[model samples]
Target chain A: MLEMSQVSYQVGEKWLLDSISLCIQPGEMLALLGQNGAGKSTLLKVLSGECRPASGAVTLSGQTLQTLSTNRLAKQRAVLPQKSRLNFPFKVLQVAMMGRSPYRGERYQASAEVVYDALKATGTAHLSERVFTTLSGGEQQRVHLARVLAQIWSPSEDNQARYLLLDEPTSALDLIHQHSVLEVARKFAREAHVGVLAILHDLNLAAYYADRVAILRNGKMLCQGEPFHVLTPATIYQAFGAIVKVMRHPERERSPLVVWTDQTESQSIKTGKRSVSQGINKSA
Target chain B: MLTSIQMHNSPGGTSCEAMREITATHRSENVDAASSVAHVVSSRRWSFGIGLFVLLVVVAVAALGVGAVSISPGEIISILVDSLGFPLAGPLDSAYQQIITSIRFPRVALAVLVGAGLAISGAAMQGLFRNPLADPALIGISSGAALAAVAVIVLGATLLSGYTAFWGIYALPVAAFLGGLVTTFLVYQFSNFNGRTSVSTMLLAGIAINALTIAVTGLLTYMANDEQLRTLTFWSMGSLGGASWDELRVAAPILLLSIVLIPLQASALNALLLGESEALHLGYNLERVKRGLIVLVALCVGVSVSFTGIIGFIGLITPHLLRLSIGPDHRFLLPFSALLGASLLLASDLLARTFVSPAELPIGIITSLVGGPFFLWLLLRQRRRGESW
Candidate 1:
């Protein structure tokens, strides 16, 4: 479990994360949803121990984050940043193998096996020999996902649950890959009992994959809970200033569908006729 | 929860033993494809390593044969064997023995040591900066040492006339080494802002610092008397003519210590290639690694410039040429560069010695003449490929 209590991060005079409190349990996927400049990445950094919070405490499993040594912290937590660019001509497998750097004591054969498994898990096995810089944006994103997966491929020595923090992992991915990547995370969480905290842009995707949803608006937590309880139309409007419909998915009943109502406005302008805008009126 | 065999649609791969074999084959094949030139270079790095060692020894021996008093290769071997407490099968002249053992050997050894030091330092700086163009001299290390050396040569007569006779031959190099270290520290400080050392900023700052140091060196040269001017010019051109057992005694320990310690950083450098944040994520202490690299490069390059003046381009070219032939795996790159660097310098020094018979050309002149064009070609090639490194 990763727990943050009244965690606030300030940059200069402005607060990026304002007294935010949250907990993520092992075997659970917690999706962090927010608009642009909503401190999603900053909060992810703080949780991953990349950035220090101004106040409050963060604990991974049972140990305080600040007290844990770097190598020990790395063995327990893996982070995939928003934008990672590699200019050198490293092979895809070599890039994946670097994820095992923290586990320097592990034998090379064992680590290589883990790297191969990670590549297979992310459906990037075919690109193992390809140069990393030659890959497409979506392919590179998946390769990095595989890298982080390989970072925490196995549990800790004491069998403590590990943490994986991903920032906008699917922003560059295609539709199939986006779903597959999230599915990989969900499966990893379920099987390995690892805690996952992902900052996502797609509301419906988050609802589908996440065990719980935490919504942030302007560095403040608007609401958080089971997707069904927190994703009502009124809450969506209050969080994102735009009106969106909260409906049940055709296949997954528990997951809510967040449909944008902006298309009707654009149609109204095109056709010189104003639609009733039922979703907006209902939210109001 | 499906195994790799099931995912890959292999019926026989259902067994763990078969899966392990498949993965091993997969990894080797990946390595082979990535280093497409692997076979043509050598079947194994060990063979390649042995080949380079043989090439260095041959070049070093060949260098011994081509000096002012030409000695046959057999005689050279005989002299080496006789010196090593073994009876020579062939008769070796006493004059030949004295020239080979005293004059050529120390010069050749110093050439090899300086070349290896500069090249390894360049490779390490390149990895640290993540830029192919990063050379220690390009970052004002050499020029800084040059400035200090020039200052000492011009001012030592009157300002330090008291201690000049006592320090004797040691003053110039000692001043140059201190100058190089101080300048490197200054450039490091200038580039680091708010605990982040920006490579682009460091490069630009290096350029400015180089310009400033060169201008100061020029001023010192202008202020020098006629004798001091000649000394400064000869020193700046860079030569192995000053190589003696005494100077080598001082420089060899520092160089050997640095060479032994640098290759240990291969894995850390490999991780750093991913980027600083990624290195940090991999549990590397970024500040410690960065600081350690700066100090190491400073020590290596400082000692080198102090001994041989400011030899340019060996550091930049050796690692890059080696990288293009071999892959960018620093484990092989660092050691191979050391061997290749030693060979290159010895060869260049031999040519510098014999190219104009008796009128010896400075080794720096030859290296710069070759390295400047090669550097330009590399830049154009990287531009054509649209790759930064």
Candidate 2:
């Protein structure tokens, strides 16, 4: 389990993240939702040791995060940061092989079989021959997924509890791949008992997938609970300043759908001649 | 997850099983010229075998013949054989034999050693910085040595007027060595962050340090009296004019140590190409590796600068030229750069002597004149392709 108690971060003179408290249980899929400046990345960084909270602490499996050595921390918790840019023509296999970095002992060379298995698991087998830099964003994300999986490679042992932290894993993904990637993560969490914390942009996707949701507005959590409890229209309005309707997904039985308020306003606009008034009301 | 079968697709140029590239970089356009060129060029190990092999033989032969009174290569060999107490047909003249054995042999050896040292230092610095443009002089190491040499030149005889001027010549290389170390240490300090040297920062710091060293060298030059100024100028411009057996005692060891250390760093340089984080992942402790390289380069450069002043370009040009022909994998690049550097410097030194004949041109001048254009060409070519290095 990963637990953060009143974790906060200040950079320069401003607080990037204020006092935030949350707990992520093993096998749980926690979706992090926030605006552009909502400290979503900062929150993940604090948990991952890329940043330290100004006050309070994040503890993993009762061991304090601040005290764990870098290599040890890497082995236990794997983070897949968003890709900005890479300046190499690193082959896809080489890029994927880097995931095994933390596991290397004195002469650490990850076994070929282990790398092959991780590649197989992530279904990036076809891209093995492709250069990493040449791949499209979605393909790159899967490659990154393979890398992360290889980083936490376990031969047969299940005793090792793992933490997988992803920063906006599905942002650039197409709709089908989005669901496919999330389903893979969901399976990894339940079967592997890997705790997952992902920062997400799509609220409906978060509601459909996350076991629990934590919504942040301006660096502080606005609400945190089960998706059914936290996906209300009022909270969405308070967080986003836009009215939206919450309903069960028509296809997925347990999934939640958040239809925007503009849909309703446009429907009324279609019935009446005064579309300009409707646009004004919607803008307001 | 790349399947087992597909993982071997992009063949790594430098795996543990890495061997010499049999891949010919140049096109076989006009196969006869290329073939004849290859046929005459000695072997595939061009820099290691051909360049050094030919230079050694030519230097050995030329050194025997180049004194005030020339001796034929055959007569010089006879003199050497006569001196060993193995009688030759007609006994070799004593004075001519002494001049050849004592004066000329050591000077030629010193020339080779200094040339080798400067070239290897340049190549190592290039690899360490991951920039083909960096040379020994680029880091202020040469100026550091020049300052030390100038100080010893100007003040040593005046301060200890009792001592013979003979000992004063040794002061410059010694002072230069210390100065070089200090400058490299400072360069390492300014550029290091989180125990890893940032190559870009290191290059920038090298520029700043080089500027400071130039200012200091100028100050020392300004303070020198006419006689001392003359001595300092000769030292500053660089030469094999001061070559002697005694100087080789120190230069040879330092040169040998660097030659041994640099080739070992090939793998480290290869890893550095992937950037620091990835290299660390590859199990290299970057800080230690960088510190070792800096010290090695400084030591070699300091020794070379002390004796020969600063020969430019051998470090920068040799590595880059070798890379154009051999490609950038450090396994081949490092050793080839060292060999090519030595051959280039020695050949240039030979030109510096023969070009002017009686009035010798400093080897440093020749290198800079050649190096500056080559440097500009490399910059332009890289700019045309985008200078990623």
Candidate 3:
């Protein structure tokens, strides 16, 4: 298990994460949802040991995160940031091979096999030989996802649990790729017993794929539970400041679909005032 | 899905259309062709290494034989073998042996070492900064060394007479090396904030340091005597005519150490191309790697500048050309940069001496004249291919 207990991170007088506690079990996918500045990325960073919390602790398996060597920590966890600024023309295979750096002196063929498997898992195997910079943004995102997957491709020799942390992994992807990437994460969680934490913007994607969902509002946990229980209309409005309606998915029972409702248009019809476009025209 | 509909309705739809066009074109290309290209890329790395080694050997030998008192290749080989305590079949000319061993040999050897040092340092700097245009000069190493060289030249007989007497011929290079290291340290310190080094801040700091050092050097030049000024001019323009066995004894080991050590960070540099945070997350101790690289660069470049003055473009262009040919894997790039850099400097030194025979043009002039046009052509080719720098 990867656990964060009462972690608070502050910059000057402002708190980016306020006493947040969360845990992700192996063989489970947890989706983190929040508005901009709600500290979703901060929470991920703290958990990944990129930043030290002002108070409290993050533990991987049973060991405190700070006490672990970077190489040891790397073998057990991998992080994929929202944007990758790789300008060099490295081949995709070479990029993926970098994931196996933590396992230094391992046979080249062994690492290559792991990397190839990771590329296949992320549906990027065919693009392995292509220059990474020439790939489309969505393709690049998937390739990065593959790289992280290859990092923890196998359980460590000590049998410690592995974790994967992704920040907005699907933002650059298309609809199909968004689902496919999440599906790969879900498969990894289920089959490989990896703990997967993904920060997601699409509530419906989270509803369909994640085992549980957690929402943050103003650096505080607004709610956390099964997606069906936590993704309520009132919770969505409270977390994002946008009115939304939550309904059951027609195809999948117990899964919720969230649709944003325009308050201006609805209120205009009720009060017999100008429509949204007319308001825009008046402002212009 | 509702999300897909909203995405289409959003203002990003135009970019989405463009992205689809790109994807369509990409899908049309053969996947097998890409795999085959990858196979060729991996195989070509070794072949390229061998080819560069052969090229360096040929260039070095040709350079050794093409001086004012031209010795034939066979005689050059015989002289070299005789010096190594292996007497060849023919009688070796003592004068030819003396010239080759005492004069041209050290000069050529220094050229190779200085070239490799500058080139490998340049490769490492480019990788560290993650900027293709970065070189040793970008960090003010060359300018700082120049300032110290100028200072020693101007002050060697006056206020610094005691200091010069203490070190004798070693005074100038030692001062220059210390100067370069100090300037680099200041730049690094200025850019480091809250335990993180901002590469942009480092670049800006480097610019500021370069301007200050160059101004100081100019002041020193204004204060110099005519003889001092003449020496400074030749030094600044760069030359191998002053090369001697004693100077090579000091520079060779330092340059060789740098050439060997810089490539050991190949994996870290490769990871760094992804970005600093990415490299840290990949299990590298980022701070240690950055500091080590800075020190190694300062050591090699400071020594080279101390000995040869500011020989430009070798460090900047060699790794770049190699990257275009073999990709930017530093494991290959660093060593190849060293080999190619040595070959280029040897050839440039050969031209510098022979082109205007008996009255040598500065080797720095030759490198810039050749490297400048070649670099511009590379940029043009890259632009034509629709590749971004």
Candidate 4:
């Protein structure tokens, strides 16, 4: 399990993240939702050990994250950056093999079995022999996903749950690959008991796949919990200022579907003082 | 119940497990073909490596045989064996043995070491920058070394003669090595901000330093006396004619150490190719690796330039040519470049001797003249084949 307590990251005078605390339990997927500059990526970076928080601390399995060596931290958590820029023409298999870099000379090596299994899991097995640079954007994204999977291939001693932190992983993918990637993440979480934190822009995808949802607005948490409880129309307006209607799935009632409404009554929600009066005026 | 999500079909209407099985089946079919392709590529690289080694030996033999006092390969071998403490029982003339042992052998050995050092440094620098055009000298390292060397030659007998007099033959290389180190440190400092080195900023700083050092070298050249001026010019163009047992004794250990340290950096260099943040995420301390690479390159280039003047393009083109066929796996590329570079320099020196017999051309001119065109052709081919760097 990964836990953060009262972490805040600041740049100059602006607080990018302000006193935020969150926990990722084993065998669960948490989706982080926010607008473009809402500190979701910054929070993810702090969680991945890429950025240091201004105050408070992060712990992995009850040990302080700062005390862990880089290799130890890497073995327990795998981060998939938004884009991977490889100047040389590395083969897909070689690129995947690099995921095993931290475990050099160890018994749990990054073997061909792990690499090929990751490729197959991501549905990128056919592109194993092709040059990575020659592949298209979506294909490259899948290849990188495979690389991170191969990094923390499985749980080790003491049954520690590995964590996967992904930043906009599906932004470059198409519809089919998007669902497939999330499916892979979900399967890995449930089967391997790995904790997953993914920053997603698509609300429907997050609603369908994420076990818990956290929404951020202006570097502070607006609401978080089960999707149905937290992702209400009022919460969506407070976070995104978009007047979206929360509806149940046609067949699966537990899941929520968000639909945008184009009406003046929604416009009243933006103007704070006259919202109640304007709602009554519109009805009349 | 969370596992129930895995049973949800994708947009393609296939469950995750079913998709995995399909992908596995497809990959199994292609595995043989892919493995065969991999086998062919590795074998091709292996043959290329062996071929280069063989070519180096053949050229070394030819180099030994083709000087002004042309000795046959058999005589060369006999002289070599006799020098190894077993006088080959025969009618070998002592003068032939003296010329080969005293003059030509040291020259060939120096060429091999210097060539290998420069080429390996270049390959590592290229990998560090992640740019195909980066050479070992791109950061003004050679210019700094050249400036110090020119200063020692012009001012050693006049202003600084009191101190440098004791240094004797070892003075120039030592000064050059210090110069290279100082300049690399300066460049590294100028480009680094908050613990990260910006490649573009570093490149721009290198240009500025190169300009300043060249201007200083020009001033030293203008101030030199006629004898000192001639020495300075000869040093600038570069040659293996200055090879000696003494200089080799000082240079060989440092060059060999650099050669050993550089190839060990193959994996780190490979990680660097993925960009700095990715490398950091992969658990590499970017600052340490970058600093280590710069110091190693500076050491090799400094020692080389001190002795051979400025041998251009061997460092740049040898790696490019080898990388074209071997791919960018530096574990193989670094060693292959060392052999290919050693042979290329040896061959160029041989041509410099025989091309205008009794009147030697500087090896630097030959390298640039040959390497410049070859580099252009490689770039042209890359463009024609539509491969964007």
Candidate 5:
């Protein structure tokens, strides 16, 4: 388990994270949702051990995060930041292979196999020979996801639990890729028993894929539980200052779909166009 | 949830073990296609590395033979071998041997050392800063070192006499090293904010620091005696004409240290291209790597500038060209940059000496004349291509 206990992070007078406590267990996916500046990224940074919280603690399994060696920590967890700035023209395979860096002295063939597997999982095997900079933004995001996947591809020999943290992993991806990327994460969580924590914006997607959902408002977690419980219309309104309606998914009984209630002029125009198309279909 | 085997059997499955098994069953065919792509890239890198090393040696040897009193290549090799305590199977000319061992050898050796040192340091800096334009000379490291060296030269006999007496010959390089280290640190600190480095800010910092150092160096020049003035002027323009065995003895080990140590961080540098946090997440102790790189760059650039003056653009141009050709894998880039840098400087020094016969132009002038235009061309190309920096 990767656990944060009452973690608080502050900068000057402002609190980036206010006594936030969360636990991610093996074989589960937790989706964190929040508006911009709601401290979702800060919480991820704190959990990844990139920054020290003002108070409280983060631990991996039974060990405190600060006490672990960098290599050990790296082996146990991989982080995919929201925006990756890789200016150099490294090939796709080369970028993905960097994920195997922590496993020093591992044979090239072994690492390559893992990298190839990761590329395949992310649907990027064909891009292995292409320069990473040439890839589309969506493709680049998937490549980075592949790199992170390759980092903790297999469980440790000692059966130690591993964790994967992602900040907006699907931000640059297309709709199909967005689902595919989340599916890859869900697959890893289920099959590999790796704990996965991802910051997501799409409530419906989170509800469909994540075992649990967490919503943050003003540096504090508003709610966290199974998607149906935490993604209620009230909590959504409180967190994002927007009115929404929550409905059960037609196919998946447990999943919920979030619908925006406060429609804008453009949305009304879109609705009018849809109604005109329906009338045309009826006449035909 | 589906079991691992069921997940693997699914059409949409991307399971690792199943993929591995499938790949293993067709391992020969699959591995060939994949490894062949990798093999071609690696093989090309190897060939380029070997080719650059050979070119360096050929250029060095050819350079040793092409000076004012031209010696034959055979004589140059025999003299070099004899000096290494391995006499070739022929009688060697005494005068040619003296010229090779004493004069041309030191000049050529210094050129190689300075070039490799500058180029590797430049490559490392470019990697460390994650900016393609980062260079020792461009970022004020060279001028900073030059300022310290000029101070020691102008004041050693008067204001800094006691200090000079204490350190003797070690004073200038030491001072220059400190200056370079401080300048690099300041520029780094100025450009870095909130864990991000702005390229424009870094370049602006470099420009500002360069202006300040040049102003101070000029002030020091104003107070120099005629003899000191002459030395300072030639030194500022940069030259390897004063190359002697003693100066090489002082500068070579430091230069060699930077050349040797920078490549070890090649993997870390490769990771760093992703970003600082990414490199750290990859398990590199980011602080240690940053500190080690800064010190090594300062040690080499400072020591090189102390001896060879402010040779520009070798660092900037060599790595850029090599990166364009061989890709940005620092494992290949660092060592290859050193080799190419050595060849470039040797070739440049050769031109400096022979271009006008008996009168010699400072090697710095030649490098700048070539490098300045190359820098502009690079800028124009980058702008045309719509690259960010």
Candidate 6:
């Protein structure tokens, strides 16, 4: 289990996460939802031990994350940062091997069964030797997922549940790869029994795959529950200011689908303006 | 789930993607497998193939015919063969043979060592810095050596008299070595903040230090007497005029030691071709590598400068030419650079000797005239595309 205890993070005097606390249980997938600047990614980084929190504690099992050494924390949790910039031509297998760094005796040790399994599971097994930087966005994400999956398991200790914290994992994926990738993450939770937390911009994907949805608005937890309970019309407007209709997915009823089935109020009617003002607004 | 995969699989969809992925994989794997084979084979063969050993024999023969005596090649060989206590068919003059053995031979050997040492140091420094513009002279190492030699000449510091003074030339090289070491140490210390040395920051530090040392050298030149001025100017222009057997003895060990250190470190330099972070992940301690190389290059530069003053391009040009010809594999690059460096320096020194009859020109003048424009061309070539990473 990974627990955040009254975690408060601020950037330049503005709180990004205000006195928040939550415990992520093993064998569960949590979706973090928020608007563009809602601190979802920062909170993920804070939990990943990439950024140290100013106050309070993040505990892995019973041990405080603050007390763990860098390598120790790396072994316990794997984070897929938003993107990687590698201008040099490193191959896909080589990058996937980098995920096994915390497990190795030295720099790059011999490959283990777990890394191989991670590569196969993500369907990136065939692309193993292809140059990583040359791949398209979707292909790169698959390779990255393979890397993180490899890191999220190690034989070092069995006392703690490994955490896979991804920042926008599905943003660049196409429809089919998106499903394939999420299925891989789901397998990690159900089959591998690891704790998974991801920041998602796509609400439909979240509602489809998440065990629970945690709504963050203006850097505070607005609500946290199952998708059906938290994803309502009022909540959508309150969080995003968009008028969206919440309905059951046609194929998967338990999952909620958001339909932006309504149009906007005229700007002149609302603001009492005589003429349209910005960016060729007369067409609208 | 397996049934769903089959159902959604368009006739040309999944298999097409998989096939393309496999082909790409095969191409990359082929490259990796090829490089790994090349690496293993190269290692198993000769580790460094110190080609300078071969060049020494050639230059030694060439140097015999070079002096004002104008002895034929056969005569030089006859004189050499005549000295191993063989009874001469005709008769060998004892004094002429002595001059050949004691004077010309050691001078030639010192020339070979000096060229190989400085050029190899430049190659190693370029590899270490991963910047093509690196040279023994570029990083203030030569200036430090220059400052020390100038100090000795201006101060009239002499340990021996007359012929002993001419032969006991090891003092200048020693002074130059000490100055180069200090400057290298200062550059390393000043450029660093945390444990790691930033390459750009290090380059800037080298440039500043280089400029400062040049300014100080100019001031020293201003204060010198006419005789002192001529003496320091000759040293700065660089030469092999003072190379005695004693001087060769001192420079030999330092050059040999540098050749050993850099080529032995070819794998480390290859690892550095990747950026610092990747190198660190590959398990090479970047700080240790950087410190090790800086010290190594400094040692080589110090020793070379001691003997030859400021012989310019051998270090910078050798590695680059080797790279153009043999590619940038440091294993090949290191040894090839040393060989090509030794050969080129000998040729330049030969030209320096032959340029104005009995009045010898400094070898450094020849290298700078050739090396400077070539260096500018490389710098411009590197800057043609995007900014350097």
Specify the highest-TM-score model's number.
Answer: 5
What TM-score, over all chains together, does every model reach?
0.89, 0.66, 0.90, 0.90, 0.93, 0.62
Using DockQ, give the best candidate's number.
4
lDDT of 2 by residue, B289-322 (tens): 7888888888888888887887777777777786
Candidate ordering by lDDT (highest first): 5, 3, 4, 1, 6, 2
The ten-residue window of minimal lDDT in model 4 chain A covers A275-284
lDDT of 3 by residue, B81-186 (tens): 8889999887778989999999989999999999999999999988987878777776788889888878888998898899899989889878888787888788
CAPRI docking class of candidate 5: acceptable
Off by over 4 Å in 3: A265-284, B1-40, B156-169, B188-204, B387-389
For all the predictions, what are the DockQ values? 0.26, 0.07, 0.29, 0.35, 0.27, 0.09
Candidate 1 per-residue lDDT over residues B129-172, each given as its tens digit:
77777888899999888887787788888886665677787777
Show what share of the native A-B interface contacts model 3 retains: 0.35
- State which candidate, 1 or 6, has the greater DockQ: 1
Candidate 6 structure lDDT: 0.71
Give residue A234's lDDT in candidate 3 (0 to 100). Answer: 64
Candidate 3 vs candidate 6: the lDDT winner is 3
lDDT of 3 by residue, A7-123 (tens): 999989999999999999999999999888899999999999889999999998878998998888999999999998887899898998899899989866667667766776676
Q: Report residue B227 deviation for candidate 2 (angstroms).
A: 3.1
What is residue A171's positional error in candidate 4, in angstroms? Answer: 1.7
Model 5: per-residue Cα lDDT over B1-389, one tens digit each = 32544454356433333333423455445456667777888998899889998999899989899977889888887787888998888788898888888899999999999999999999999999998999999999999999989999999888989988999989998988988998999999999998887888999999999999999999998998899999998768899999999999999999999999999999999999999888878888888999999999999999999998999999999999997898899999999999999999999999999999899999999999999999899889878977766
Instruction: Give me the TM-scores of chain B across the candidates.
Output: 0.86, 0.78, 0.86, 0.88, 0.92, 0.79
What's model 6's lDDT at B124? 77
TM-score of chain A of each: 0.92, 0.88, 0.93, 0.93, 0.92, 0.89
Candidate 1: regions farther than 4 A off: A263-284, B1-43, B87-91, B157-174, B192-197
Return whichever of 1 and 5 wins on lDDT.
Answer: 5
Interface RMSD for each of the candidates = 6.5, 14.0, 7.9, 4.4, 4.7, 7.8
Best by lDDT: 5
